[model samples]
Each structure stands twice: as C-alpha cells, then as structure tokens.
Target: AGGRVLLVEDEMSILKFTARMFQKHGFQVHTTAMNGLEGLEMMNRNIYVAVFTDINMPVMDGFECVRRFRDWENESEERRSLRGGRQFVCAVTANAGPQGDRDRALRTGLMDAFVAKPAKIMDLVAMARRSAEDTLGHSNGN
Candidate 1:
C-alpha cells in the first residue's frame, strides 16, 4: 500500500501493531487518539487515502468521526466531490457480536467496510490497499 493512511485507535498496543504493519508494507501512516474530535481535526488538516478506525473510542467515537467526515464531504462546495479527498473508513474492532452494530455503522455514511478483532484476518491490509486503489480510480476518472 503505497498510499497514505489515517489510523484512529484508542488502544495503544493495537495502534502500535497496526501502524507497524502498515509501515512495513510501504504505507505512509498517520495515527491519532481514539477521540473523535481529535480525529476530525486531523482529517481536516491532512489528506489521506484511507482511514482505519476502531468503533469504540473515548471522548469521540468512531461512528461520530465517520459522520463528521461524511457530512463535511456532502456539504463541501467543491463541484467535483471526488477531488474533496476520499477515504475508505473501516471499523477494526471486536464488537461484531450484534447485527445492529454493523447496521448502525453502515448507516453512519462514513465507513466503507468492517473487520473483526483479535484481527485474525491478516489480509485486511490487502483489502485496505485494494480499497485505496479503488478510491483513487473513482476519484481520478478511471
């Protein structure tokens, strides 16, 4: 994944591991606290190709972060929405036990996908890479 990634996670251990993995795979990664407010500030300051955030967080949660991101995109005055900078925001969490959890996440209008934790799915990085590629293609008129 040569593209840049914005990672929002509350757990220090998980955040470190995930950031290391992305770095090892050639991704330019930026991380933020689990707080939604902080994450939103970061998003507003920088342009990233994808965003991987945990569903559960302190201060501000993943759902709210996604909502803010979506709302900003929708309300931006730019005529070409894609040029506004697209991100594939996904949930990396252990809370897939309930169907409503996933449903609510989808309804938030920010996430592009979900992945369960203890993170058995090692291929998630690959999926994220592909998602980045797809986002770029869509934005660039491929």
Candidate 2:
C-alpha cells in the first residue's frame, strides 16, 4: 500500500511531477523546500511514512539535512512519527551513480535508499511500498 510521503525538492518541475505521481499511486504527499533546515522543520511538524529528498540545494544540501535528521534521533526523547524509526529517507539525486555521493549518504545513516534523478515511476512506487511495509513492521512492534 502507498503511504504518506515527505518530498524535499528544489526543482519545481521535478517536484510537481513527482507529487502528481504520488497522488496517482494513492499516497498522501507533503512537500518542503531544497533547504535541509526547512525540511527538518517540516518533518518535525508532520508525520510522514517516508521521505524523498534531493541531494543538492541552495541553502542546505540533502546530505546536511539527512545528517541533521539522523542526529535528531540521538538528542530528542520525542521523535515525530514523521521522522521516526520506521520512516525512510531516500536520496533522489542527479549524481549519475557517483560512488562518493552514495557512500556519503550511506555513511551518514540517513538514507534508506538512493535513486538517480528522472527515476522510473515504478521504482518510486516500489520504494514507497517497501517503506510502508517496513513502517508497518515497526508499528507492530516487530
């Protein structure tokens, strides 16, 4: 089943198209800017089952956003379900499979998956489904 999605994107066109796709697939969608800081703030305010964020932006990059989100897990007692254990964050970048970028995302423990830009609709749907399943498992105390 499709789940709630938090989309952090800088590119307007991509964001619009992706949002549309999420809607078509029966997922609830929330959106934020390219800035990691703002995205973090949004996550704190809402409960998303999964997040899809871009890698680069003007104010704060995706890497920094992910880092902050991961860091939040340590310092806070009240973790928002939007940004909690079952919520997955995925990198949707135009890095063209750059190993360093992928490695950085992995090392930070922020992203659960990475997909190159212009991602296939099916891929996005599949990831969202997987995230939903994972979240259900966590919710069930698994």
Candidate 3:
C-alpha cells in the first residue's frame, strides 16, 4: 500500500496535476479540497502522511486552516499518540513578489515544507519521502 495524502487547491488543474504526481510517486490515496475550509474538514476525519495546501484560497486561507488543524491535532495526547510521527503539511504559494514573503512564511513554522509556484514534482515527492521517514522514526517512542 502507498501513503495517503491530501491536496488542497482551488485551481482544478493544479490539483489534478499534483494528485497525479503524488500517485505516480507511490501516494495511492489522496483527497482533494477546493478551499481551506474544506481542507480542514477533511483533515479532521482522516489521517494523511502529508498534506499539500495552496497558500491562497477562498474560504479560510491556508495559514488559518493549518493553524486550526495544528491546534486540533495538539489538543490531546490521544490524538498525538495516534500518529506515527509529527504532522506534515506543506505550504504552496505563488507569491513571487518578494523573497521576504516566503521567508516569513517559513519562519511562522506552520508547515513542514514549502513549495513555490511551478514547483518540480520530483522535488516535492522527494521531500515527502524524507519527511515521512523522519516522522515515522519517532513512532512508538523509538
């Protein structure tokens, strides 16, 4: 079986492409959301090895969604224990206006990784693989 993943994007094309790329790289099951609000709902009911969310979207932007999701995730010991490792979520942005914007987002620590617009699928897949390994290493308190 392949890892489970979630793709939160408003653009249909990007969503489809990202999902296909993830599947090609061994993420067999992936859920999609058109907005951040929907993304949060999906996160509440499922377990995903990774989540790729666009920074800008209607109905609750990526930042807020991730913030709330993290809050919910850290709410209880049981919830945290249910995971094999740390929560992994990536922020995808098309903000090429300034490098400071990207740097600020990273400094916020809301996501495990960040992917700029026109990102390379191979790079994304590689990062996910590394993150999964690192996260899983913390499983069973080992």
lDDT against the true structure, per candidate, is 0.74, 0.77, 0.79
Tens digit of per-residue lDDT, candidate 1, span 83-115: 435556777778877675577776665678877
Residues 1-142 of candidate 3: C-alpha lDDT, one tens digit per residue: 3477788899998888888888888885455698999999998888777788888899989889989988898885666876653578888888845664367568788888888898888877877777666556666455
Clashes of each: 1, 1, 0
Q: Note each model's CA RMSD in angstroms.
A: 2.4, 2.3, 2.0
Off by over 4 Å in 2: 80-86
Error of 3 at 107 (Å): 2.6
TM-score, cand. 3 vs. native: 0.88
By TM-score, who's the top model here?
Answer: 3
Candidate with better TM-score, 1 vs 3: 3
Sort by lDDT, top down from the best:
3, 2, 1
Kindly indicate the candidate among 1 and 2 with the higher TM-score: 2
Clashing pairs in 3: none
lDDT for model 2, on a 0 to 1 scale? Answer: 0.77
Alpha-carbon runs more than 4 Å astray in model 1: 83-85
For model 2, what is the alpha-carbon lDDT of residue 36?
74
